[model samples]
Target: MDFHVLELFSGIGGMHYAFRSAAVPGKVIAAMDINTNANAVYAHNFPTTSVCNNNIQSLTPEKIEKLNVNMILMSPPCQPHTRVGNRLDVDDNRSDGLQHICNLLPLCQGVQYILMENVKGFEISKAHDQFLDALRLAGYQWREFILCPTQFGIPNSRRRYYCLARKKEFCFDGGHILDDIPIEFRMGVIDGMMISNLLLPDNLIGPECYLPDKILSKRVWLMDIVTAEARKTMCFTKAYTYYSEGTGSIYCPLNKKEMDIVFAKVKELELSEESEALRLELLKSLKLRYFTPREIARLMSFPNTFEFPTETTNRQKYRFLGNSINVHVVGVLIKILCS
Candidate 1:
């Protein structure tokens, strides 16, 4: 059966792409977001779909009902639930969008399926409670998951919270947290997944990706460095490239022995200007660099057909990608949810 979908908080159409990747027959009636750059990217890629630049809170039950959509896919603002944030949740002004959606649920009776993605901490929030209450009041049965892309045989470690709800009978009996990726939903080879498989040809990795000497000398210790052969990477945030520690992993194009030598010298260095200079030089030898946006997109399981418009800046690319979902993982979830 074909589904009419309304995507809220759509960033570069990740949910739309994932929906298509699921091989589910669907039409995205409207893709909505406030970010102009993201909307531009979505429009560029999905010329046939309507991309709306509007705040989620402004979406009324009347407006949504007019679309006659059965499925609602959303990735709401996660800042309020992030560990680093104040954890204001429903109290945070940023959460107004999701809270508004909850208010609309009861009035929009035609909506049968809802899928949402957010940071891992969301399940515990007051916003989550409100959402659950709304779903229950609307006679929807839901399942929640705390999944990572690694579970889907992707090398990246983006542990996130997902909720799949439907108005139909809950055929798949389960508790709130899905502990495993059901065999039916599994894709890719778990044993063979590596960062190397997602990397671009060396020629495409430009010198522009190189880290500055200042960051190398001061922030090297905090960087989560990984080689191409490695199977995992830290979760990349929008702050990637702008921040070093905890922002994301850096690419290290050096062998184990070379990395060992460089780190050993770094450990021995005193807190002096001379030591900082030596640290910079040592790190420079490693040729450490940020993963280009394209590499991150690949790691996120975006298809090769995905492309940023020529006018989109590198920073914009990283920001949109960081905000987006892992298409492959979400695709599997969509198949399970829609089935």
Candidate 2:
């Protein structure tokens, strides 16, 4: 099966990379996104492919028909349904683009397969019901999943919602929906290592990767700190470096004995300017740091070839990656969809 994909809300071409890695006979005919920063990165990586910087709402059936793509890959704006967001569902202006795509489904032609991903809470949203209605009205059969990278032994926990749909004429190979990722897709040692085994050597990591003494002393208690030998990491968000609690995991290179000693001294001090200064001094010895954007991309299953433009800032890279999909997980699904 040759897949000519129309990628919507395409951020940094994660879906395009997944398609290439899936070992399927496919190419993205055109990718559409309104984010200028994401558009620059996408074009940097996929120079031959068309990367349109246009709003989804502006798409017409005629425009879509001209592409004649058989598969549609999209990760709509997740802000409205995210746990930290306002939970506005379909009412949020950010979701208008997704609603526009749903409305366009019945009118567009040759789109036989559709795959969408979003935050976990999206399953219960009114927009999701509207999407199902559109799929049904367009004569498609569908299966939904809430999957995490850890299920495939990747060692990072970023649970997300995924939906795969095909025209009624086609059938899913075993056809029964499992609440979990199919057992056949489960594997160990993705891209040659789990997170525990993949920690980059200090020489490869830059000085900027280390957490500042200010952040270390203030939010030390709230951080989800892990060591190089740990098998798992918390979900990393766009707020990773900007915010402390619940945003993401921090790395500590110190061994158990050294880390314990630092905490022991912290316990002896009370809350005061003098104590805070002492605490900061003690915490500095532990040598804690954040996982670099490149490291986070590795955890998200993006290939080593993936690169942000030279001009892209660290914050920009984090935001784009946080909004992107797990390439390895999606590659497996793409194979399943084509099968």
Candidate 3:
């Protein structure tokens, strides 16, 4: 039977892409988020589906029931649980958004499956305990794994925690017993054979961001994958960010080849007067110009056919991408769940 999914905090439908990858007869019947720009992008990309822009706190069980959703996939805000953000009081309003979902869990009477994705640090949070309690009280069976995207053949190394839960009848016998599992489950992507198997040709454009000159100059001496016996390169996040910045006007490492590439691209694009002005201002800081939203969307593994509303600003686009789930990672989880 075809499953129907309801995506909560569905920024640009990353979970939807995962469902597609599973190829299990299923559809994303509804998606909800509070950001207008994100909602706009989701709508543009998924024109036939219903996209709600209201805060999830206002949603009613009756409304959800109407969609006949069999699965719930959520990626709640990481800010409340993140180390970098304001470590607000447990009762702080910032966490209220997440609390609302926990409260709504019991109300989702018909949902047979639930999947949540979040930062690796969520395992220690009180909010996570609360979430587990609710799932347990609901008589659901669940399992969690801390997975990195590289294991699945993606070039990125974003490590995230994924929880898979099912109603009692559908749960696997060993679902909750992860302690005895082999250490392979926790292996970083660099150790995975899949990375080499799916390695794209070197010509695939590296991230468009820029990096410092010192790092760029060092690249020449670094061994190529076939010749060099290094197990792994730098972490993807830092490398991508650094490369994107280096490619732009940030600090032109005094290297002729690198400078030529950046200057040529800048001239080729002939950015708008306003963008040029912003670029100049960014140059003053010596930090590489941030990736265009389109570039970010690509890095997140959204299809080229995916559309973003023309009305959204580049900065807003970056925020949306930053908030999105890594599509390839989600796809692997969906495959496991469906299998």
Candidate 4:
């Protein structure tokens, strides 16, 4: 049950949180990421752990050897392989870190299990091919999953690609190395919790742990989204607050009649025909505020005690939450492989 974890590109130590929060007995020996902001948050939450803010390409075998961890968990940068990105694949500079990790796979004597999470497009990317090739060459068997939080009953719909690889010595039953082998084969059903179930009662939730009420006071459409009977929404990205187009889900609890009435008002006010600012004001008036950092963190399955530094801004917090992994979902995956 002893799991020594090495976290690569460890944004906010999401994997580290999963490793510890799950039933598995493990500790992250070291976590590496180049983003100082994320490292700060990771350090804030896990003060005792070693968090190295450095490029992955600089992660030498000697460094891996020193940590001497038995498992690797990472969610490498997905920009290069993302649909909106340049789709540079393995040619992208960001991929260098993962490539470096791949190179170290054969050299790192203690690494036995690997769990990599990335955007859905990653499965088809050349970078994925390179990663799989490395694992195969290193004699590790892997299973691929295109999983979403909704599958486990959490409302946020973040469909990601996960590759769970185990050294041959600890391999699964020679299963399809590129398919979503049922985790249920080993781990039982993960208890389902609706988004409403996760939220603390309004009276109990701190008044200040949310966006300012005045900004979204008029936006009636921007109400509780994770309510009972309706428990789902879209993926959250770093652009969550900065760009609302496809960022993440909102808390809108509007009913069909109410939605029609709101749209009718938009048409009546001709807000769509006005300046962008005016249209935004109209939208904001619908009570559509960004999910408070704490709410988003809760949706992402970060525990109540997980907090940002006092100086961290809401925008920065949103970015961090959007980038961090869903602890509950990832915890299930780890339990499946480790338990």
* TM-score against truth, every candidate: 0.95, 0.93, 0.69, 0.84
lDDT of each: 0.88, 0.85, 0.62, 0.74
Segments in model 2 whose C-alpha atoms lie over 4 Å from true places:
168-178, 187-193, 256-258, 270-274
Candidate 3, residues 166-238: lDDT per residue as tens digits?
7754333454423222333322122433223332334453444444444433442231111112122222232
Q: Which 10 consecutive residues of model 4 have the lowest summed lDDT?
A: 219-228
lDDT per residue (tens digit) for residues 33-84 in model 1: 9999999999999999999999998888889889989999999999999767
Off by over 4 Å in 4: 169-192, 199-229, 253-257, 268-285
Query: In model 3, which range of ten residues has the least summed lDDT?
Result: 223-232
Per-residue lDDT tens digits for candidate 4, residues 239-337, read 876654577755533454665566576666664466545544655444433466777787777888888888888779887887788887788788766
lDDT of 2 by residue, 4-68 (tens): 99999999998998888788897999999999999999999999999999999989889989998
What is the TM-score (0 to 1) of candidate 1? 0.95
Error of 4 at 98 (Å): 0.4
Better of 2 and 4 by lDDT: 2
Question: For model 2, what is the C-alpha lDDT against the true structure?
Answer: 0.85
In terms of lDDT, which candidate is strongest? Answer: 1
Error of 1 at 134 (Å): 0.5
Ranked by TM-score, the better of candidates 2 and 3 is 2
